[model samples]
Target: MPFIPHTEEEVQEMLVAIGAASIDELFDEIPENLKLTQLDAIPTALSEMEITQLMGKRSLQDGEPSCFIGAGAYDHHIPAAVWQLTTRGEFYTAYTPYQAEASQGTLQLLYEFQSMMVALTGMDASNASLYDGASALAEAVLMSVRANRKSKSKRVLMPRTVHPAYRRVVHNIVRNQQIELVEVAFDPKSGQTNLAVLEQYAGEDFAALVIPQPNFFGVLEDVDALTNWAHANGALAVGVVNPLALALLTPPGLWGEAGADICCGEGQPLGAPLASGGPYFGFLCCKIAQVRQMPGRIIGRTVDLDGKVGYSLTLQAREQHIRRSKATSNICTNQGLMVTAATIHMALLGSEGLERAAAASFQNTRHLVEVLTAIPGVEVMFEQPAFHERVVRLPAPAKGILRSLAAHNVLGGFDLSADYPELGNALLVCATEKRTEDEIAAYAQKLERVIQLQGGVTCGLVPKE
Candidate 1:
């Protein structure tokens, strides 16, 4: 809507025509206690140039910090065209697709999103989208329990290597619903799930087993073995994956002979920015046999009366429309806006472009590990091959070192002491393709200088370019 400020004369004429003396007289029905009569907190409005200058000063105060943390949200480079096209009025101001005939564009976009997710995860079908990665995993857990007719137990074998925050969310959401999350431990050496410990529960009945590729510690897991074992025990294999890593790693659909039954993961790395925490959508895809059990809305493409191509909502399980007990899920609306950006991002960067970015990220992470380990007391914490992130053992306390790094305008990796106390003084670092060689060297130099200082030590700051 365009703003057209009224002239004082025009306003007075309108007031006279309405039999009012002033604008305040038009609201005479309001009670005295309901009105606010002061504007003391607000400053006088400034001119355009003055406001622009003031904002520039504020932007300078908020320095552009270098990002090396990728616990769940990533800092991948987005193509300029992705957001440029997505933010156009047609896509940006769109709302829910309640009317199929009038909402063809929105419905088609969602249908394309599902198709892309199906291709990426190698699953039979995919819903529009879910809340975020953590909640999606929680939903996947519940879905597996309901879909597994072979096992009556609501027990799920959850690996300790999955993201700690995700586990907390799952427990909070499903604990009161009679779901039991049995945590499986990891091997200290490889940072991978211990197959020996898993063998102890060979014949036990469980609904599903969650397999995280490049588990929380960033170490790749034996996914094929885990998937096979889950199937042998009459359990469904649910894969918690990173969509970007799927460019180089094996898709969950081909994990074993019969393949993983379901796959779910965070979609931040696709195109969404890590603005503080997120606005990223979670993707869930499963085999055709269990499509009815999936949550959220699914868009289906079909031919109309004139043989025209069309898209419409299918298998909607809203609580308002079905019996309370028979409704498959409580998921109502899909995250259409976030998924729109992801679809554009994936389309711009075809399969080959995504592979190159993944490969570059892996190479940069490997190089970062080497550069940091060259310091006298820094070393890799795990022996298993990792993707783009790794847990490094630091000589000094991780919390203090990270605080000191922030002073240098560098946002270091996450400290694992609070979550996994067993790995004492460990830091999880990552190197996205965005990190330049100069940035890596500067980080190493500052880290080495910080490690050498016992007491109060003076260090030079390296301003970010």
Candidate 2:
């Protein structure tokens, strides 16, 4: 029932009926310190029309800028029909397929999502989805510790080249699980994981080694060497990948003579957009033997009683569904809406279209690097081949230059100094297929102006930390 205003007589009668002298007496059991005296910070309620106008004005502040900033989340062009079809009442409002009989449509879509991810990663099987890329990687690490029979140690080797945010998430989630994470350094010159350092720890009693392809620096790693080394040492090779890059680069499953045991990555590049930070899904794929250890839910195809084809919820290892101790993961729900969009996108753009998109992104990124490095004080940090992102050493602090660029309505790349303080004045920039020649030219011109205005420091000299 809706709340209605009470008359003074009725209020007094209710107070008398409840044996309370005043409204304040109703809360006599509560402590004084726990009670709020006034709400000083909250503003007075505004009219609907007034609020609508205010919100609209603020929304305009997020207008499309010439975006180049891609640390992990990317700006990909999502088709209009993708969301329109995904957000239908049936798909958008559907809940988890707890009762498989009524959720055929949702289950079928997720099955398709799994099939596409498996083909892309060249893995044996894939789960429906997970929270996001960071948590997915964390879950994959936890799975390795349980599934790997050769090494019983709780130690995992993590490369510094992995996205710092992902590393932090892994630590935050698994730190209390008695897992030991050893940090491996990257080669300063090539911006790849230091193979010598990795080799040093390869023989250790580690359960898994986390390798990032087109690592956080955007430089491709020696996947073949790393995968072979990890497997030879009896540790599972966990590949943290960018799904789009798989179209052009080698898939994780084909990394070495053996193959990567597990693969996890952000699925945003496939179909999800950079909605500020996200609403993106994470995909996890692994060998068939490790399917039981995989987290979240997996949809499987089968035949009905009459021998007709159908889809249903298959593997669910969540604590909520199974015994707590036996559960492989505690992840509650998959990002269903995001997965729906991703599946539709992959279907729309078949294998050929995906490859073309990945190739174009690589070309655009190379062109962007060439233009940025043309400036007197700008220099590319790594000579190794990269995908869609590159580290460029800047004369001054990248944050300051980026701020200046923003005034020109350009979203420059991420400031590496924030996460990688050792990098000094480096900025990690990306150029996706969505970028145009005009946008790249404009970014170059604006960047050159910023460098000159800031009194271009010597080339190759980063400002001292």
TM-score leader: 2
> What is candidate 1's lDDT per residue for 363-407, written digit by digit as tens?
998999999888767778998999999999887678998888889
Worst 10-residue stretch by lDDT in candidate 2?
Answer: 456-465
lDDT of each: 0.88, 0.90
**Residue range 362-415, candidate 2, lDDT tens digits:** 899999999998887788999999999999988899989999999999999999
Lowest lDDT 10-residue stretch of candidate 1: 456-465
lDDT of 1: 0.88
Off by over 4 Å in 2: 1-54, 317-319, 458-465
